[model samples]
Target: MLHLLPLRTPLAGLGLCVLAGAVHAQDTLTVYGIADMYSEGIWGGGGRVSRLQSGGLSGSRLGFRGRENLGGGLNADFVLETGLNMDEGTYGQNALFGRQSYVGFGYEPAGRILLGRQYSSLYNLSSDFSIFSNLSNGPSSAVVGGFGGYEPVRGSADSSTGNGGPARINNAVKYESPVWGGFRFGVLGGFGEVTNDAGGNRVVDAYARYAQGPVDIAAGYVDDRGGSVTPLAHRRSWIVGAAYSFGSLRLRGAYLAVDDRSVANQDGSGWWLGADYRLGVSLVKIQYVVNRPRYIDNARTEGLGIGYEYSLSKRTTLYTGVSYFRNQDGAGLGRASFSIPSGITSGTDNDLTQWVGGMRFSF
Candidate 1:
């Protein structure tokens, strides 16, 4: 008295489930990340020399991302990314959940708007200006004054906050517009994350960029209204850059200026130019950078760097580079970050020449 279902019908049901999964795939969550490591050495740290260290090739990190289609043209997206020290198993930047944590809506035609913790336009735009860019084997020459311990500011020094400028903003809202004909723009606001006065610790930032074919151009500015903190009372930073490529040859140039109203020499200006060429499985790049601290009486510094990278696979590569710095007027800007770690200092000086080599992998 029971009706028998066809055995093949089960297969059909399974096919339907698979099809449903695909159709609803946009509503599903996914996980993705990368792990990288490398060694580094510094010739001079303003005066002292440092030994080899891990993470010179790349900044090790792991992250997760998820997106959901909310019907119609709306979508939900979230990213929880964190950095790690591969050598010692230490976490990077901020507390446990500090790297990037936020949820936001996105539109294909319009753009993406994210809330919570994320990168600002300054970092987003200027990242390409540096040869290191989480890829080089050595430290960032931008750290010290550009000459190595001879310039006033050392590695990763906060020139803007030198005059009491605010560095990072909290409780910020960021908006990025889609590219139209190779042009796009971004704007962000930091809310101080304080419940007391709404506009007490507010900061505003914006940037515009254009990429047409092998040429890239961008400019940005950031203004921070310091809270009750010293040496961060007020700060402003501005940057501009252009890059172009022809065949296997590429060239780049950039300029940066920061104003810190707290330090004795509250104004600073910096600039750099470089080029890269590809040869079979290897890529070669060279760059020169400079910076000037305010009220330093013609205090300036410059750097010359050459880097090479060899591809091991589609997602893996090894690289090495060397740089020389010459300080003018006893300025040691070149060796600033030579011995300092990334995102660790504010307004210190360490000018020196640096050479770095490293490898990286991503998945």
Candidate 2:
């Protein structure tokens, strides 16, 4: 049960005749959220294509986070976050609080352990190293397919129509290790919640990262074990990425791979090269990406993205971005699908190009 209190009392003259303690209280909860939207035009999927979307700047969200120190280096923390559709009042991903819902215990030196729904360790590491946080409609989203560009052990493809792990997971347990001299690690497992043996754990993932001075690096792996006809497919995946920062410029690169038994032994790899320039009122970034998925034949994609961000303040910004992705001819042997909604086939194409523009706000 939750109790709410006011901060006023009327009987102060009678030496505390009113419930002053219940009437006066301090706020401990923090409310925060973001609203992002975009206009997009996709080509080569079939013919002419266009759509309006949220998350051009970032995934739109509304959430509340609260934590209270219980004393003795122990504290309680909880989060209730949900995705939003700026184009409509309805929820974007369908699931209520489709973004995340979790509660956990935290310790200063020991680290944090959380329960319920949350992001996979692989996702945590990837997003940390990504230049755009992998926004759905942002430049990175079009180039690398954001989080969807890789295997689906951690999440689903943004462009797929099939059910996906594009965002968060249910029945998940996550542990985040404390940063020791800029080094930290994380591990997580998700329950399939299936009865009568639908499959095993469904997914398990982990990652380790180090960031000190001007350089940052990380490595991670993810596995998806399931029996669904279209399961993310049991697979082994890994990523290695590094970034170096110099004054106002930062350069980064990453490699990714996935091998699966259920999915025709598909193999793929990708790399990123980019730089960011920060100005007093805005920031500009330019990046390039190349990914190839090996199938019976072979499929490849080369992408380029440029972005600009103008901050109105710390919590709000005006943002715009554009990207071009070329699907190499004769590179259509493997499944290298990436898009919003994840796993859905937009159409057939030997190539695809995209453009997006939008803004983001937080409160």
Candidate 3:
């Protein structure tokens, strides 16, 4: 069950309580969702697979959010988002609200504190500098492994029980600062939910960024304790990224590193570069990503992806893409993110190639 904090004593005694009540009565709530599907084909070291599935272009999802102006530059806000699979007719992320769920109050020029399951600060900042917007392309791909979301053991993940690791943490408390002169930051921590562990069992993340004119710079770090309640068993990652825009053309670059003290042979680092050109409502995007796992020879992986997207309206878009991956000696792990997760598995095909076509609609 989700817990809510009690109002401060002073605020409760003063007229603030009444004002909050009045504002709460005028709050607004809205329902929203996105649907994306794709046809995908892949040839990997594992095998050749072709299938239709939900793509990660925007990660099909449904959400409900609301806000209430509480006066004095303060406001109450909450979000509940769930991942959905249009093809399987099932909830994608395993939890009732897997994508995001948080409630908090915000101050106009200060910041806000939220409580519940939420996205890592690193992921949020990283997306700002990604041409692919943290999709299954470019340097964002390496982020999966860096954040300890990599499935080195395969088969199943802690988040899904049979898929992969967690993207959002539970029992989390987060703080996000308001932008000041194009500068902002966010921090987060997820308790282990165990009594005896104390501060050792927690997931912590932080990020900061500055954007002005045509240039943007961002940096982030995350220390994940994984599923263990032990302090030393931690997986950590840090990244620095930048993006620049000129007219209709934009360029993005990033360097990411991971310290996998919790897993053997999983420690590694990599980088990515991306570019895109916008022509009215249409865009062409391409990215190159490389991953190097520590202590493993010929066990490196790299990929190149090219994609095109056309917006049909404010809430609809059409997209298609192709990806090619090369896995050195022992590096051909499992699958590459072809947007279509299932169809892109690298089944023993050292050279993994994939094709995808999809459309997304939001309402």
Which candidate number has the best lDDT?
3
Question: Candidate 1 or 3, higher TM-score?
Answer: 3
lDDT of 2 at 92: 57
* C-alpha RMSD of each candidate structure in angstroms: 8.2, 6.0, 6.9
**TM-score for candidate 2, residues paired by index:** 0.81
Which residue runs does candidate 1 get wrong by more than 4 Å?
1-30, 45-50, 134-141, 144-168, 262-265, 328-334, 340-351
Candidate 2 stretches greater than 4 Å from native: 1-27, 138-154, 157-167, 196-199, 228-232, 330-349
What would the per-residue lDDT of candidate 2 be over residues 1-363, giving only the tens digit for each residue? 132223244543234324223223332455678888777766555454578887766678888666767788988777788889888877755667767889989888899999877776555655555666555543342233222234432354322322234235567778999999999998877776656754553567688889999989999876666434445456666777788999888877676666656646666566667778897988998877776666524456777778888998887788777766666655232122235322222435556656667777777
Q: Write the per-residue lDDT of candidate 3 for residues 1-363, one digit (tens) a residue.
A: 122233445554355444233233435656678988887777655457777777447778888776878899999888889988888988866787877888988998789999987776545545666666666532245333432345321112345321112346677888989899999898887887646755555778888889989989998887766555233556677888899999999999877777777645367777778899999999999988777766565666687888999999988898888878776664335335443244334445466777778898888
TM-score of 3: 0.83
Report the Cα lDDT for residue 89, model 3: 86
Cα TM-score per model: 0.78, 0.81, 0.83
What tens-digit string does per-residue lDDT give for candidate 1 at 189-210? 8775446766555678888999
Error of 3 at 181 (Å): 0.8
**Candidate 3, superposed: residue stretches over 4 Å from native:** 1-26, 137-166, 229-232, 263-265, 331-335, 338-349
